[model samples]
Target: MVAPPKPIPAPPPVKRAAALVAILGGALLLLWPAVLNGYPVIFSDTGAFISQTVVPLMIWDKPWIYGPFAWVFHQHVSLWFTIIAHALIVSHMVWLLGRVVGWGSPRRHVALCLALAALTALPWSVSIVMPDVLTPVAILGTALLAWGWPALSRAERAWLLVLTPIAVASHLSNLPVIFAVLVLALLLRAGWGVVMRAAVPLVGAIALLLVTNVVGHGRLSISPYGSTFLLARMIADGPAQRTIAALCPERGWYLCAFVGRLPDDADEFLWNQTSAMNRRPDGTAIFLGGREIAPEAREIVMETLRREPGTVVMLGLGNFLTQMTRSGLGDTTRRRDVGYGVIPHLRNGFPAAEEARFQSALQQRDELNAWALAVARVFPLVLILAAPFALLGWARAHAARDARALGLLLALLVGMTGNALAVGALSGPHPRYQARIAWFLPLAAVVFWRPRPGVIPAAAVPDPARSHTSPG
Candidate 1:
C-alpha cells in the first residue's frame, strides 16, 4: 500500500493568528463605544449592581423577583451602569457564539456579522441601559445549553442546568423564552438525565427566593405594601374619574386642550373609575395586577378594553410597537438626576424648556419607530438568505448527529420564534420587545448557515476522484 498519507496538518499559526485577530477585532468594534462613553453606570446600572450586590448582601428576601429589584434599585442606580452591563453581556454572547460555531469556520464569521448587525440594527439597545441587556445573554445561554449538549460531559451539562435559573432570574421577560427552550430540549430527546441536570440550579434559585422572602418581607412576594398603597391612592383620587366623565360628555371642545395635561391625581382617579366599571361581575379584571395598576387604574383600563376590545387591541398593538422602537439608555436621565441628588428637587420644579425638549424627543422617537417598522418588514428576506448557509455549515459539521448542537439549534428556533409571537400577540410588536428576539435572529442564521471546513465544496462533490482529494 502507498505510504500512509501524512496526516493533514492542523491550521498553520498564521491562520490561527488571523482568526484570533478577527474575533478580537469584532469584539472590540462592538464594545468600543461603551468603553469610550464611560458606560451608563448610574441609575439603572447602580440599581442592577445593587440588586446583584446588596440584595445578596441583605437577607434573600422577596425571592429576588424582577419587580422588587427594579423598584428598589431603579431609583438609586444610574442608567449608565445598565448600558455598560448590556454592552458587556452582548460581548460575552459573541464570545460564546464563537466557541459554539467553531472559531475559524465561516459560521463563526456569520456569527460575527450577525452580532455586528445587531449592534447597528438596534443601536439604542446596544447603547442603552435596561433589563434588555439580559435578553441576549439569556438567549445565548439557553442556546448554548441546548446546542452544546452532546459535546458536553455530564459535569458541563450540570453546570448549565444550574446557570439557567440565574439567567431567568435576571429578567422576567426571559422566563417564557427559557421555558420554551427547555420544552424544545425535551422534545429533541436530550434525555431526562440532561433535563434534570439543567433544572437543579433553577430549583435551587427558587428555593433561595422563598427563604429570603419569608425572612426579609414577612411575606412571599416583594411588594406587600404595594396593594395597600394602591388602595390608598384610589381612595384619594376616586372623584377625578367621575369629574372627567361628567366633563367630557357634558363639556365642549375645551376638553381637548386639557386631556393629557391633567394633574396626576385627576388622571389616577379617572383611570381607577374606568378600571372599576370594566371589571367582570365576579369582581376580577381581565388582566392581572402588579404592573403599576391602582385599583382605579385597573378599572379605567379595563373599561376601555371592555368598551372597545377592537380599539384596545389596536392601541395595545400600537403601544407595543412603540415600546419596541423607543429607547432610553435605561432611564439614563433619571439615573443622572439621582446621582447628582437633584431628583427630588427636579420632581418639584417645572422646567418648561425641558418639558418641550422631552416632547420633541418623543416625536423623534416615534419617527425612528416608523423607520424600524419599515426595516422589520423586510427582515424575513435576510433570514432567508443567511439561514440556508448556516444550515449548510451545520450539516457539514454533522450538527444533527451531535445531540448538543442539534438541541441548541432547535431551542434557539423555538424559543426565539415563540418569544417573537408572544410579544407580538400579547404585548404587540414593539421593536424593543422585538429587540430581544431580533438580536438573536442573526446569530441563529450564522449558526445554522455558516460553511464548514475540511469538507469538499459542493462543486467537487459530483467528482468522486476530486472529492477524495484533499485541499492543498
Candidate 2:
C-alpha cells in the first residue's frame, strides 16, 4: 500500500520584513534635514564629528585624527556611511525582534506591538546621533546569539561570537548591557566554556587596539588619553570648584580668565580645573568621569544627610519623580554652531547667514517650560499603563528553554534601572541624564510586552489530545 502523503514543514517566519520597516524609517530620518532645517537640534558629539572629523576628511587627504575609526573623517563619506550603517543596524534589530516574538505566527500582533513600542516612544533613540542609537541593536543581537546558540549552525554561532565585541565597541553604554548579557548567559546555563568562546573575539579586539596605539603613538594608550589626563586634574580641584564651574557661568568665566592667562593651552587648563574637582583621580576615567562623581559627592553630602537623612532621602525621591515626569523629546538647550568649525566647505551648499539662523533656533528652548512639566507629569502614567503588557512578554520569554530570552529581559531590567539610579544619583537628577536611559526603557517594555486577549502563542500544536500526550 502506498504511504499517506507527508505534511510539508512550514517556512521560517518572514522576520526580514520587520528589518525593512526599520531601514525605511531610518532612511526617512536621514532625509529629515531637508525639511526640518535644524534636524539634529543639539550641538554634541554628533556636531563634534561633523566639525572635527567629517569636514576635515572631505577637505584634506591626511590621516584623520579623531576617534578610533579614521574612516569617518570625511563629511560626505561619513554621512553616506552613517545613513547606510544606521539602516542596516536598525533593520537587523527589527528582523531579529520579529523572529524572537514569532512575527509570522499568531503572535505577530505582539511582535508588531513590540516594534511600535521601540520605534515611536523613544523617537530620539531611533534618529539621533548619540551612542544610545546602538544600544537596542547590540543588546538585541547579544540576546539572540545567547538564545539561539544551540539551534544555530556552527558557522552562524561563530559569526555571532565574532560580532559581539564589535557590537560592544560601537558604544560605551553597550558595555553595561554586554555585562548584563554575560551575567544572564551564565545564569542561563552557559558556563565558562561559552564565556571563553565569546571572549576570544573581545580579547583579540583589545590586543589589536593596544598594538595600534603602541605602533601609532609610541605608547599603549588609545585615543591620545586626552580625557584621562584632564580627569586627573579635575579630581584634585575639589567638588565645590567643579560644581561652581558646572553651574555658574560667572565661575566658568572666572576659570577661563584664570586658565587663559596661564602659559598653557586655555582649553586644557580649563579642563584640568574642571576634572581636578569634579572627577575621580583614577588614572583611567571610565564613562567620561560619571562613575566617580556620585560616590565622592555622596561622601561630601553625608554630613548634610546625617543631619537630615529624611530630607536627603526626599531629595533622592524627588529626583526619581522629576525624571519620570520630564519630556525627553527634542534638543532645546545646546546651541548648534556651524561656523565655529569649517564654514568654507558648506558655504556653497548652505548660506552662512541661514546656517547662523538655524544655529540660533537650535540654541533656543523650542518647548515651553510649562509644556515640559505637563509632559513630564503624564509620562509616568504612560509607563504604568504599558508595564503590565511588557511584564507579560517578559514572562513568556522567561518560560522559554533558551537562556538568551531570560538574559535579554534581565539585562533590560538591570541596565535601565542601573543607569537610571546611577544618572539620577550622580548627576543630581537632571532630565537630560535620565534621557540617556530612554532607549533602554522602551526596549525593556517591548521585551516584556504582552498581546491583548485572543492572540495565540506562536508555536501551538494542532491537536489538543495529542499535545496532552506529548512529553514535557
Candidate 3:
C-alpha cells in the first residue's frame, strides 16, 4: 500500500475560516462599548495626542509617540478608526495568547474575549481614544515573546517583535511594567533564550522613546517631565509638603510661598489655575507649568525621599494597595466637559464635522454615566470573588506541566502589580490606571482553565487524550 500522506500541521481550511470569523467577532465585541456610546471615547489627554499631529508641540507630561500612533489610524478622519484599530490589536493578541496555551480553539478564544469584554474594563479601554488599551497589549505581547516563543509560528514571533515595542513605547509606565515582568520571568527561570528575546522589545521601546525625546524635546531622557509627576505624587501623599516646609525658609524655593495652602490632590496642585504652578496670566496652555519647574520638582522629590523614607514608603504602599483594588471603568466613560482641555484640542485638530460629532456624542452628554458606573461597581466584586478559583486553575495548569501557561500567569501577575506601583506610588492612584490592565487577570484565569472530561466537545479539544500536553 502507498504510504499515507503526512498529516498537515496547520488547521484545515474550514477550521481556519471559522477561526477568522471568531476573531472578527471578538474584535467587534471589544468595540461594542464605543458603539453603545455612539462615538469613540475621548479623555483629556486625547486632545494632546491629536494636537501633536497638527503641530510639533511637545507636551511636557507625555511621550510624542502616541500622537503619531493616533494620526496613523485617524489621519484626521473619524476617531472611530483609532478605536477600531486598538480593538483589532487587542483581539489578535488574545487569539495568539490562546494558541500558545491549550485554549487554541476558536470557540474558546471567542468565549474568553466575550468574558473579558463583559466582566472587565477591557472594552472601555479599547473604546477610548487614549493609549490605555496598549497596557494590556504590551503585557500580552511580553508574555507571548517571553514564554510562548517556542510554540509561536515564525510570523507570529516577527509580528510581536515589531508590535510589542511600539505598544511598550506608547506609554511611559509600560517600560517599568515590562521590565518588572521580564525580571520576574528570569527569576522563575522561564528560559533565558525566550526571556531575553522579550527583552529586545523592552530595550527597543526605551531606545525609541529616548531617540524621540532627543528629536522632539532635544533631550536624551525617556521622560523630561517625570520628576514633575513624581513631585505631584509626593505633594499629594504628604511627604513632599513636610519636606518643602522644612527646607523652604533655608532654601527659598518658589513653592515656599504656599506651605500650608498646598492642594492635597495631585490634579489640584498641578491643574488648578489658582493653585501653585499656575498657567500664565495670558491663559496660555502648559502641562503643570511645563519643564520650567522640572529642576525644582526634581529637587523637591529627592529631598522628600531623603528626609521621610518611612513615611514615603508607607504612603506608596497604601497607594499601591488602593490601585490594586481600584479597577473600574467609570473614568473612561465619564462625561467630557466642553471646557475640558481635550475639547479645544479636538476642535483645533479635527475637522468641523468631526468636532460636531464629538459634541453630540453620548459621552459629551454624560449619558453613559449610569450604566458605566453600575458596571464599574458590580464587576470589581466579581473579580475579587473569582480570584481564588482563578488561582486554583493556575495551580492545576502548573501541575499539568503547562509551563508556558503558568509562566504567562506569573508574568501577568507581576505586570499588574508593577503597573499599580508605577502609577499609584510614582504618580497617584487612579481607577483608569489600574483599569487598563485589569482585564488580563480574567484572561489569565481562562488560560488556566482546562476542559472538563465530557463537558467540552471533541472538536474543541485538538486531542482529547493529550489535552494536558504542554504547548511548548
Candidate 4:
C-alpha cells in the first residue's frame, strides 16, 4: 500500500507461464533461512511468546494472540508453522500491493513482487519470530484500503480488511503507529469515510488486544510497562533525572536511590536484564515491584515535561528523525539459533537434551545478511530524503487535487514517525524499532512514482468513498 498502485500500460509486464515461477522464487527467498534451519529461527523474545502460549500465564510484554498461536505449534511439534504462516501472510500482502496499482503484464506483476522482496528487508522480518513484521502489514492494509479501495476487487479489499487488524493486534506498539497513520490521513484531507473504514480494524485491534490480555492475564492491562517505558525514554532523553533528583529520599520510587547510577541509554536501563527492574531469579521482571514503580513513572514524565518542556519536545523530534533512517535487517534478534531459544523454556515436558538436536540445521545466510544489511541501512535514509519530493510530486501530479498517492506517502511518513515515538521515544531508540516500518518508505516511493514524460495526470486520481471499488 505504500505504493499507490497506479496503472502499468506499455511493455507487456508479465508472461503467463513465468508469473507463478517468479512468485514462488520470491516466497522461497523470503523463507530461505527458515528452510535452512529445519525449524523456524528463534529470537530472545520468542521464548516469551512460547512461554505465555504453553503456560496460560499472561506475560504482559507478549500479546495474547501470539502466545496461543505459538503454543499450538509447540504442542504439535510444528514450530516451522510459525515461519511458514508468517511467510504466506506477508507474501499475499506483497502480492496484493502489486495488483492494486494494476502493474504490467502478468510477468511484470510477478517480477515487481519479486523485485520488492529483494529491494527491502520486509521479508526478513517475517522470517524471524517476532512481532515487528506485523507493523508493515497494518500499514499496508490500511493504506491500500484507503487509497485503492475503489479499484480493489472484493477479494483484495477483504484480504486487506482481514489482515490489517490481525497485524495491528500482533503487537502493542502497532496501536499507536496505526493510530498516528489514521490521524495523519485526516490531517492530509483524506475523507471521513476513508478514515472510518480504516478505523474499523484499528479500533477492533485495540479492543481485541485488551480482551486477549484480560483472558491471558485474568485481569485487564494494556502493556505492563507503558509508563515505565515512557519514564525510561524520558530518562534516556535526559529529563527524568530532574524529577528523580527532586523526589529522592522522600518518595518510595525505589529508583530514587540509584538516580546517579542510571545508564546514559534507556535500553541499558530497561533491557539490560540485570537492571533493578529484574528482581526475580527467573529473568522475569518483578511484577509487583514494577506496579509500585509504574505510577511514579507517569508522574515523573509529566512533571519533568512541566519542568523542562522544551527539552522533551526536542528529544521527541530528534527521536522521530533518527527513526527515519535507522532500519537494519536482523535487528530484532541476535539472528542465530534454530529453536534453542524456545527449547530451554518448553514447560518441563520438553527436555534440554533435545536442544542440541534442534540447533539450526544449516548455518550460512551470508548472502541474505549481506544484501539485507545494505537494504536496511540505505533504504530508510533514501526514503526520508525523497519524502518531501515524493509528497510534492504527489501534489504536483494533481490540478488542485491530492488523493491516494499523497495519502499513502503521508501514512508511511506518519506511521514511521509515530512508531519511532511509541517504541523508541519511550524506553529507547533502537535501529530495530525504526527498521520495522522504515522500509515502507521506498515501497511508497515506487507506488506513487512520477509518471513518464507527458503522462498528463497520474493514474487514478482521488475519488469519493462511495464511488470506489477495490481494483479488479
Q: Rate the local accuracy (lDDT) of all candidates.
A: 0.44, 0.42, 0.77, 0.62
Model 2 segments more than 4 A misplaced? 1-42, 51-84, 101-121, 150-164, 170-173, 197-218, 222-380, 399-402, 421-437, 450-472
Q: Which stretches of candidate 1 lie over 4 Å from their true place?
A: 1-25, 32-85, 101-123, 149-163, 198-201, 208-212, 221-402, 421-429, 450-472
Best by the lDDT measure = 3
Cα error of candidate 1 at position 193, Å: 3.0
Cα-based TM-score, every candidate:
0.53, 0.57, 0.89, 0.78
Candidate 1 — worst ten consecutive residues by lDDT sum? Answer: 456-465
Which candidate number has the best TM-score?
3
lDDT of prediction 1: 0.44
Comparing 2 with 3 on TM-score, the higher-scoring candidate is 3
Q: Per-residue lDDT for 94-131 in model 2, tens only? A: 43444444442324433543444334334334334444
Ten contiguous residues minimizing lDDT sum, candidate 3: 455-464
- Please, what are the lDDT tens digits per residue for candidate 3 over residues 1-472? 5552232244555665666667777889888788888888887777778778876587778888888887888888778888888887888788777766656678877887888888888898999888999888888898878887756555566668878888899999898899998887778786667678769879989999999899988999998878888888888889899999988878978788778878789988776776677754345545557477788999999999899898999999999999997877645676743247666766777778887888787888889777787666757766786677668767876787666667888777888899999888887888889989877777776676562322212122122123222111
- Tell me how many clashing residue pairs each candidate has: 45, 17, 0, 19
Model 4, range 112-189, lDDT digits (tens) per residue?
A: 545555656666666677777778878878877777576554445666676688778888788888888788768867
Location of the lowest summed lDDT over 10 successive residues in candidate 4: 457-466
Error of 4 at 292 (Å): 5.1
Off by over 4 Å in 4: 1-25, 36-39, 69-75, 218-221, 280-292, 330-341, 346-357, 361-402, 450-472
* Candidate 3 error regions (>4 Å): 1-12, 279-288, 337-339, 451-472
Q: Rank the candidates by TM-score, best first.
A: 3, 4, 2, 1
